[model samples]
Target: MTKISQLDANDGRAELMTDEDVIARIFDHIDNGTTDRGQSSWKEPAVNYQSVDRLDAELALLRHRWIVFCPSSTLEKSGDYIARDAAGIPLIVVRGSDGEVRAFRNACRHRGVQVAKDEGCTSVFVCPYHGWSYGTDGSLRSVPNGDGFPGLEKETRGLVRVDCLEQAGLIFVRQNAGADRSESVPDMPDLIPDSFRVVKSEAMEIEANWKLHLESALEGYHIRSTHQTTFFPVQYDNLTVVEAFGENSRIAFPYQAIERLRGRPKTDWSANGRITYVYHLFPNVIISTFPDCMQVVVIEPLGLERTRQHMFLLTDCAEGGEVLEAVFKGQEFAAKGAIEDRDVVMSAQRGLKSGANDFLEFGLFESAIGRFHTVLKREIEIPAF
Candidate 1:
């Protein structure tokens, strides 16, 4: 019955349970063989996964919402830029010389081709198709054949800007071209510190519905069965502490090592490395924190049955080499569990095609997934203004 809210709060930081408090809960769950549960079960229709209309509706909501683009550390340098697809729009998030982050449509104004590909540092972006160049602030700087089009207005023909916001050390972008600038954005909790730096980044397309990937991330019910070989040995199965924050939620998965803090003094305890904190940002961002490192996973829907995962490995850059080595080791362990989860979701996607069940039933332990579906349903039902 203990919650993180009971833990002492740090100045200007979210309240978190001390190691002693969390250890007590772990023991309680072990004895009772029960985890945090929801008030009721949820039944989700299969059409939500197979219907093109449903997918379109979900995409519409995502377009207007502030989805995570990347971590602020990814654009640490003044000219660093990351080019990727958000929902379906090709977006380029770049840091200007003034240390401000901005996002814009990646397409070149001359033609419809993308101007930037992948990520790198550059003072100016030169289009590979033509010689059109743009500054870090997204202003047109040069054009090769300027005289070819006499009526071309360089000032107004710069890159099309997208709505961008940076908060809590994360970068977010709204893909809707005409989205209201004054629209209220969901507040993001401080999940990672400013000192964290992106140590590695990976991009891959998964053969599963984006929701399926999110469901896998939101609960620990599948650890014993799905991740038995990878995670179950070191982590308890079907045990988690879920806390809701607006449209988002945080699921705490404790490691077996948490037992070591049972008799430790409360003031001397830390949750770092002893618990895996998975923050599910409304819609499609997953920020997972381990003792040594943090990861940001952006789930972008490619189609009804396909999704692109942008994974970034982050660690405290100010730490020493030994600390970094431990962080990298922890990241590898997490990566293994991720691979196992991917395989399970891909299998579920294939099974859904068999028309075996009309709906998928989510139990109480999977409450976070139910909460996500509720938010998605509410957003889709909103009338367009």
Candidate 2:
């Protein structure tokens, strides 16, 4: 239970466990033949995954929580913006000229049409349907006809504002306007450097429950079986350093090459090329740090049987060379592993109708997934506002 919150007290800027510290822990676990475990095993009802009512409840709960929309690197310049669906709400996250990040409902005030599409840079967002335009700060800047709507107050006709904050190189938006902004966000490791820049952005949909995809990233139990040719060759099987902080957690997958540091000086130890850290930013986002690049993954439920995944790759390299080569290689390796898990989760989703078991049992090795369900249940129980 070495939470990041306990690392330091710098106004929620707690230090992440250093590479030296994390490496030592991994070695200790390897020698002791034990991995982190939950207090107890947990079971979640199988029907919950398939029930429309449960899906609705979970989607509502997401609105009351701060959801990670994208990495700050994605919006590197003022007027840069990304528009997408998050928690079933169309959102536009833009960086204003003041160098502050802001979010607004994508729908235009005039015709309910989305003012922006996808990602780009623009000082103003114009509705294609009615020529209504809004500034990057979400102010209604102009209208198509000046005399048609004489009584229309432009001050209150701007795009709906959403609570957004850029912290620790990540952008988080609270969909519910009334949600207290002081609430805790994910306690993350300081992995994304200020030098990092977005290298690629991609989106895809999978025919599976979002939780199933999240569970795939939380445990290493399926590495040997599911990623035999992709990750198992370089990474150890079922060996991880798991730590929970607040409602978030980090699971480190150590590479076999870590044994090289066995007799080396502690000061020389580093996690750079020896491990991949998968951070479960509670509810629906995962940020994984690879050797050459880091990826931010946001999953949004598209339907009872579908989920959309937004993936953004960021790196400090700005030109093509060995650095860029390694970055793309890392991205490809991660994508392969993801596809393998996607296949398995889709099959699992299809299995929900089999009625084979009432509850899906999570073993000690899959404790992070168990913790996720526990936190989710608690949040969903508090009637959605």
lDDT tens readout by residue for model 2, 85-200: 88999999999999999999999998799999999999999899989999999999999876999899999999999889877888989888443555446555465788888889
All candidates' lDDT scores? Answer: 0.83, 0.84
Candidate 2 global TM-score: 0.92
Top lDDT model: 2
Worst 10 residues of 2 by lDDT: 1-10
lDDT of 2: 0.84
Clashing pairs in 2: none
lDDT of 1 by residue, 1-385 (tens): 0112211111122444554666567678877998878777789999999999999888887887778889889898999999988888888999999999899999889896888889999999899988899998999999997899898888998999988888888888887734356543545567778788999999988999999988999999998998888789999999988777667777889888877776777675677867888889888999998887889999999999999999999998788799889888878887888889899899989989989989989999998888788777766786771
In Å, residue 377's CA in model 1 sits off its true spot by 0.3
* Collision pairs in model 1: 273-291
Per-model TM against the reference: 0.92, 0.92
Off by over 4 Å in 2: 1-16, 183-189, 318-320
